[model samples]
Target: MLLPPKDSVLRQASFTNFWISRILSSTSFQMLSVAIGWQMYALTHDAFSLGFVGLAQFIPMVLLTFVVGHAADRFDRRKIVCLCQLIEGGIAALLLVGNMAGWLGREQILLAAAILGACRAFEGPSSSALLPQLVPKHILQQAIAWSTSAGQTAQILGPSLGGLLYSLGASCVYGAATIALLTAGILTCFIRVERSERKTEPVSLRSVFLGLEFVYRHPAILGTISLDLFAVLLGGATALLPIFAQDILHTGPWGLGLMRTAPAVGALLMSLILAYYPLQRAVGLKLFAALAVFGLATMLFAISTNLVVSLVALLLTGASDVVSVVIRSSLVQLQTPDEMRGRVNAVNSLFIGTSNQLGEFESGVLAGFIGPVPAAFLGGLGTIAVAGLWMYLFPSLRRLRSLSES
Candidate 1:
């Protein structure tokens, strides 16, 4: 049997460094999330306030998507990623200081989140576009799987560690996040990639929307991206997890940490499996099936009051999501032209950021009005509905058999 693709990809120094940086950066972000969620809930004791956190981040990313995508295509992606990490580190430091001095109000946290979102708007496209440059075409799928696994591992560690540190003090969690983010930035600086070759063609309105045009033209890509967008946009249950931890589960920070980590555990396991085995046949059918499972699992989580049951449901949700992620990511990277990868990825990032951050906002608002449990239940149904709708509308997506086929 062949050695796992992860092992092969890791043999290259650049890929290894990039992988390490991913782990560190993901860890920092995860820690920051726990700290922010706990602190915000403690301060305001309102569900809407939690939603506002997502809103604060989402607005800047949406506003800056076009420019950030352009910059990624036009500039050195590594440098852009490094700079973004540095800025995120600064934000973590600010949070640390504010928490220590007791002046970090809800507004200040939201402001920091907005700035961090702006940095990520640039960072997401650049970092995503840089991946294909790191490894051979044959191992790209493995690389994506392993990279996601590393992120999932960080998500597992970060939340638990963050929650434990929160018990010490919110400032302690922020302090740890600051260190992790700065370390990631430093590691990113060591990655060596050639500068992007600039196109001789002058910039024009058409050039600006090229990524959008590509996705519009390719129904397969469009189907997959939009499928995830609408599904997660309506179905994401993460925003109301704090409420679930506190009121529904009747667990404290420790329980909250477990809740956060459960999905990652599932995702990490699934990613490892795909890394070794890979998907060979019936890829599209598998993708749709996984999404349907994710929706069902989410619905299970919504109604469960038992911690163990909720954890299991969340684990299944993460496991199901990994299949979709691996397939979708491969399609996006492999199908896109190198020159347009950055812009296309930026558009994809916009969908992702919208699904995540805006999804959180929607969850919070709905939870405030309708209650957390019902909100989650409704979201799950919406997810299921999207899967069915997309299955009917995008027969091309359903018929997709392999990444290599695209």
Candidate 2:
């Protein structure tokens, strides 16, 4: 009798296609962000506006979280993701035309940002839920690791490429982004997966709240998810990089691109290592340790005047972050059933979005009141505190020894 191929997810055709799609989409998203951030800062020259960019995207994510989660559970996730990429591609084209025609303003940018946020609200949950369908159960953790590596690869390219393209013009960046997103859309369309039987439960508050309850009831899953939520919420300093690049680092758009790229570099390297080696033991202790390192790295970046030092600090943050990410993601997926992945992942997505977008807003507000340096310093300190607190609050998480520990 014929048998399936070896254990590597890379050998699976569907998984390969999924990984490629993720890389393309992630790269396009990163490039788009670089353009939006630099353009917003250039137009408004204010920290609050930068913060507002995050808020604009975040608001839609918050409002649609339940609906999108339900849609992922009930609909064809591939189609949902494909539709989002296509719409985002069109949005990029609109930005391109608007920029070239001199009609793009802060409002237009914010509007596009809001639309993209809504699209991601659907895309993030569906894509995450689709992963387990592509690989065998035994190799799922490796698949998650590889998937992270794909995103990091995109991050490595996206910011630098976006920054470089921006020098030519914002239009150049937008045009390239449009093409990348369109290609990603097409790629997503071809990805194949054996989806779980769709949940036919009528849309209701009870159904929508199921994911939240599922997460809350599972202490380990809740711990990992909340751990990431709070850690990133406190440690996120990415929103301030444009300011750091232009003002403190004494660099231009190109420098900002590199600064944005630094963490991805660290993350990609770490993810690749994890993909090959995989985490074997003391996973819980490692998660907290990574958070501590990430916090320390954030603190270092905040205080550094030299660009090189800052980049190094950022790199450490990324490397440490992926360790926590791989562990958390693996645990969440393994713990949840296929039928529940969509809703559960949606809840997870909300926490992630909240941490990232809210963190940006918080950073901007804090930076506005005090200064970027003090604001970032405090954020790092806050992240460390969250780590310590979570250890005590979720001893189950702290005691976790493996992703499959059950």
Candidate 3:
């Protein structure tokens, strides 16, 4: 038997279209985030309000997960994704109008966040579940890695662009995001893939809970997902970044942009390396080790008062996170059956949304009480402890060797 040539994922037209669409959408999201975070902090000067942004987004996403997951599995995923992107673009347009009207305030931004979150609840599962249909199974890991690299590349550019546009005005930043999202939606329409056969089971409590049941039965999946949930939930430092940029490091919006870009810079470099030379052995142990480094980096970032030092720490955090992301994503994609991918990914998205958005809320609330520096320090400590405990608890996950073999 002969082996197929490497980088075959690049040859697929549907995957290429999907990849480009991802870049556009991810870039728009990053830009929108930068604008919202900066504007919210600037308006309220309250860390709690900044946290509310995450809370607003998190609530709708978690609330609608099951319904959206069912929709992804039941309907045409491409259309679902395309429609969601269009809705997101409309939200961006709303933000632009509000900003230009000179009446955009914290409440309006929070409402926009809630609306965006609702769209994303549907978008996440559809997009994730759609990927396996675009590429051959043998190249799925490569496809995932490359796709992530593209996203990281967007992160690298998005914040910097957002900051520059923001300098012109908040409306300018929103305008750019609107254009990107609309373009992404257009690109999404061009993607062509054969849909998987739909499940014919009648809708019921059992059908709705099928994804949860599948994940519950698999110890490795449960362990990995839960580990990320708690680790990032505690250790995420993004919410306090405005504080770090303004009060701690004494930097303006331009400096904040650089601070935000540091992690993606690190992740992008690591992703490029992984894309060519994928993780081939000791996948589980490597994940744990990378997570340990991530925790350490968070602590280092917490204590750093100097701008350059903080950037380095953030860079390390991003680099370490890339390893975890690639390994975990490959594991989830490989282990999941096609029919269950949507629902399973919906559950996975909830974990991610909790870790990211809810984590922001936690960081904000903690910062309001304890101060930003100590909040981050404590969170980092919690991350390290979680990693150690998870390693001991999930022995099967720890002993896992390869993505393909698993």
Model 3 agreement with the true structure over 328-397: per-residue lDDT tens digits:
7777788988778888889998888778867888999999999999999999899999999999999988
Instruction: For candidate 1, list the clashing residue pairs, or say none.
Output: none
lDDT of 2 by residue, 1-406 (tens): 0114554443376677778888888888888988998999999899999978878877888899878888888888889999999999999999999999989999999999999989988898899988887777777778888999998898788877888999999999999989988988998888877756665888788998888999999999999899898889888999899999889999888788778778989999999888878888889999999999999999999999999999999999999999988988898889987777888988988888778877888888899999999989999999899999999999998998888887
Q: RMSD to the native, candidate 1?
A: 3.6
Q: What TM-score does prediction 1 earn? A: 0.85
> How do all models score by TM-score?
0.85, 0.87, 0.86
Q: List the residue pairs that clash in candidate 2.
A: none
lDDT of each: 0.86, 0.87, 0.86
Candidate 1, 139-162: lDDT as tens digits: 688888988898899978887788
